[model samples]
Target: MGKMAAAVGSAATLAAEPGEDAFRKLFRFYRQSRPGTADLGGVIDFSAAHTARGAGPGAPKVVRSQLSVCSVSESDALRAGLQPVSTWRAYGLEGYPGFIFIPNPFLPGYQWHWVKQCLKFYPQKPNVCNLDKHMAREENQDVWEQSKALLRCKEVTKRRPRSLLEKLRWVTLGYHYNWDSKKYSADHYTPFPSDLAFLSEQVAAACGFQGFQAEAGILNYYRLDSTLGIHVDRSELDLSKPLLSFSFGQSAIFLLGGLRRDEAPTAMFMHSGDIMVMSGSSRLLNHAVPRVLPSAQEGNLPLCLGTPLPAALPRDTVVEPCSVEDQQLCASYLKTARVNMTVRQVVATDQDFPVEAAEESERDITKEGICHLEDKITHGKRVRLDPDS
Candidate 1:
């Protein structure tokens, strides 16, 4: 069979199966490491022209999406380290509404800034991370600083003790998420980073969402072998607002599933600097990062992410240039890692958090261990909690 035909056959098998969770089946298929048996032909590569199986016979599933270029000023876009709004290549899937995918719209050398922030800035104190649950406050104060010297060492050995940065699994910003309750509590709020909020607003505005408030942020740090389990993001009180996700470092296979578990999902590649805005009908759909692919070259990842400062700085650019030392440390760390930051607006503009109920509401079906699920077959996979649980 031809490549396209084979892809369809593989996907069809999942849909063809009776009484099985198609989304889960596909998730397991992509995460499994059976070298010769695994077929990636079914995966959609948005960076390239690829056919989406269920779109139609011989039709590409990705459709050109229009952005509100006029909504964002050129000055604002530059400040956010993004290319002009007019230059962004946005697309929508055939079957998915309110989902927007922009392939690496970052200006040259700009991604370095975001990468540095995720590693060096966001993990600092005042922000909460998975390690905080078990570690003392003083011990986990500076994740990047504590691990910088060790990570910068050239001779990497398996036996070397892992740095604190390496041990980091996830970091929460703004309104910190509660794993047990699966809700954003009013009392658990922190000052959201202004830089990230600005960036999120610009991107959201360009995507046609005016006044999009970025109230919460989750940064998931993934190693090459890492896999994120299937789950939905419904913790936010305002389901109408879009959830913005930004990717850096190595690429990963993203599976966007339907509302029902039995409904099969469409797989796509999310490369560095890529951004996903899930809103409208697509806002609460199930999704997962089944696998993180190794970079084609350890030295240069995502290809578009060049040197720290590839060109002369624009006057008053918001994204500061990375220092030589910081660049080296970030680059070295990224050679084996990927960072994903998802910004969310938890509450509507007019809405206020109601009194904390005596019992947690069971509206969101988040799988337990969403950020820390361990795959039986793999070492660092984390499962998301289901709302029903």
Candidate 2:
């Protein structure tokens, strides 16, 4: 089915009727406070038993876990000091209840440093052309054309490209120009401020991924009606690496499925402060945002600064200001649109060294201009070991 049709169908399935308790159950689920919140101590044992009983292969697994909830007492709700809030488990979609509070788990020292740096170097104006614009100007044109051609074709063929690994490329920081006059662009793994790199490392460590390296970070803003179709992120990156995604501001429904593009998978409503790590066997899963609900004018979730508006604002208006009513409304509208910052590790296949020999040596060997040095070294090393003994 076409993307729009599928989106419409999904929306219809999730649509609420008049007087029906659509969000009550979900809201209550997140509001409840249970002790041992961080304790996945028992859940793992239960999951193992369940998996043994013919659980589907795609069933969610307990990857790395953490817990944090809203500090209600500290909350200005009643002008009281920040009280201890309930902790919650951050599992994949399966472990998520309707609502959960994800804390900003950055170390206070590092967080304060970055915030100060950003404030000090804040841009006065937006840059006209950024990595997204350049990418849209270059790769997007080809993708658009390919998509059109696919639509025109009567029968589609799912053939792998000639060089699957080579298709993945890397964009270096030096190549990107920040148009917004801001010191920072959306490029991932840039060598600046040291804090971002550290944050990326923490995320990678939490998710049990090794050799995590990101060349560029894509920053996308979704307002009303902004939507991305069901597509896999098969850009210039090694598919072997995981795509680590982080969402902030507002909330939206995330539709995720299996490797096949046509497979009917599951859907989850991802809110702000949520993190999703897609890796391992699920690296190639197809995912997309079908739609973004309009943000309410006021009373939305507080931004990072604990303020409704930041000094360097991007959107025309804040989705939700600090108000109880606005929070509720923002929560409802978040079911529509949210800003998602997805971090991916892109491996540049072309620049990778050959497994057997150095680049120059490999070229010479391939051209029949030299002996296989790796084999000779192996043979020599084997004999030398016996001789030494």
Candidate 3:
């Protein structure tokens, strides 16, 4: 047989030019360090993730084609310090069914800064980069930076000071569920990050969500001790759409079992910057993450993607780039953990997300709760869970 086609091949050399103004406005939000209103002006913002639908991301000047957005040449990824794990059947119906993993598309420095911004996005703040709540904060702990001084001095602290990303038992985003009430609370709904908005659109194009629109985001932060039980993603009004998942900072052994828990699950590796899309059959499968492996840390991941890094953030632009020290620090931190951000369209349109339900203050306690779980699929015969979990 001919060489297997890579899911993210270098055939197309299109660059991602979402524009300076877009970045400026966006990073400005980061610079200011204040939480703005979570209520977006219109569905247009929500439609940022959609492909071939409405317009595309950063298209105020010219309409960008889907191919252009999704096409990140191998050279670009490599130059950006990343590599695509290739496979002929890595994606598509004829290939390995419905799941695809494209490793490290963004350059390490770029990705590092982007992730930092995402972690500090205020609205998602505190909980976004949470610390172990069960353990009380030590008066002498440096929450932002892990200290080696304590170990050097033999002044052992009661517990290791870890970021939320380091020791989170579990964390959820987008819509918060009232477990006692078994209903989603409107009070808890917040707009997904705009920086990630375009990314959803780009990945949607690659995954064939021709009309992808981001309605929700669920972030699963894990340490080595963590495990995600089997579940599905069916809370959205439309099942036809796709859910885009991104893995960062560590590797995990993901099990793709058949339709039920009774059957055994096949194992797969999920590393940093790997993208998983759930469309078609793989969208519905029984999957679980039983264990996490330490990631082969690559914050300065050296590849030759051929894309040039921005020399500077632009004048008056003035947002801080990740210092070499910062990237090194982050790389060290991510060496043994993982953060999974899964974005899905809860409803195709604003109208589809029931207005009445959002307005309702409380859920009916007498009714059985809608507990949807599960995520993208992999190689297997199976029934999956909802995107909510």
Candidate 4:
């Protein structure tokens, strides 16, 4: 389809954990659909997005079933209900990169669990980092030295673009998406965490990417001035699946552009707790964050994320001190920083996506993974850098 078609009704099933199985039968919800029963009184949709899927020759059929509508009440206002789809405003020039969204999945109380999971599983420092095989650099000793110094600094700040040592601070979950080599390979990988995999599926399901398995993730740490160089992600064997992204702490100026680096990217603000989905034609477009905005910009949104979250340390038997330390480090640092967690599918189907070609190709051009997804984000030429002193 040239433009992504919006499905009228949403479908979802909620199942509690095994410990709560006994209560499932007692409170079964038998939601039924009847025509012309949409309640418009309690809700307001002021978005520029036209009423999707109206009736005509090629019009969509009226579905009086379960529906979720997330429209902008104002440039900064947000409204969310039971649905777990994307709700923040979207911007794009051509309709080629289709954006389908749902209501905000971010909840103030419980949704913090996702943030906690990120700190628990991912590493902020490169020494113990399991991603990208930074340990394999036979000659780049600077990567190790710069990374060590980057972690030692307690205050959050982005260094000049002349050096990309800050990127070495991120952690990758799932399949360990590799940027230097440009593909996912078993030769270097970290098994995708089960909790994060399930979370990715939940976020994807609401946005029409059902059965989506999260094969890769790049948990990017953005200091107040950090800027991700523009890039594209074609490493994944499958582009059909939607990419899931979550923003925590400070906001960011996300850029979405055409297929090449020459295309001037459109900028948008991504608030913490906000979710972004990129599917259909938009899957392979060029995108990047030129800078991490200060927390002062929280006035426009983040009404749900009231007052900064306090430092939390969740216990895990396997990785106790590690998880706790990460939590404390992130919690203290995030007071002036942001953490962008993006999930993407790497290998398409069960087929062998041999990384033989990706490793040999010397092409330094930037490609993308998906919406707001920084899969294998590298410092490409598009980004403006400060001249070295």
Please report the candidate that would top lDDT against the real structure: 1
Candidate 3 per-residue lDDT, tens place, 1-389, comes to 01112111111111122333222222222222211222111112211234123222222221232223345444333333333312211222122255554545554345565445434342233232123223434521343444322222322234644444343333345564344343354555666655565567656655455567776676665554455655566555666777788776666655444454443333345656666677667676666665555433332222221222355643432134666544544455554456677877766554455675576536532232233222222333222212233
- Let me know the TM-score candidate 2 reaches against the reference structure: 0.42
Highest TM-score: give the candidate number: 1
lDDT of 4 by residue, 1-389 (tens): 21112111111111222343211211121112111232111111212244233221222222212212232222112122112333333322234445443324443433344555554435533212323333443333344334433444655333523123344346566554544455554544567776667656665654556578887787776655455655565667787877777777766656555665444333345666666677778777766665555554432224444433334423321112224444444444455567777788866666665767445333321231222222223444222221000
By summed lDDT, the worst window of 10 consecutive residues in model 4 runs over: 5-14
Tens digits of per-residue lDDT, candidate 1, 167-224, equal: 7778888876777777765565678988899999999999999999988998988877
Deviation in angstroms for 142 in model 2? 28
Computed on alpha carbons, the lDDT of every model, listed in order, comes to 0.78, 0.34, 0.44, 0.46
Question: Could you tell which candidate, 2 or 4, scores higher by TM-score?
Answer: 4
Model 1 lDDT, full chain set: 0.78
Which ten residues in a row are the worst by lDDT in model 3? Answer: 6-15
Q: All candidates' TM-scores?
A: 0.89, 0.42, 0.57, 0.56
Off by over 4 Å in 2: 1-88, 93-193, 294-299, 302-337, 348-389
Which stretches in model 3 have alpha-carbon errors above 4 Å? 1-96, 122-159, 163-173, 177-184, 295-320, 359-389
Model 4 alpha-carbon drift over 4 Å, by segment = 1-96, 101-104, 124-168, 297-303, 307-329, 355-389
Ranking by lDDT: 1, 4, 3, 2
How much lDDT does candidate 2 score?
Answer: 0.34
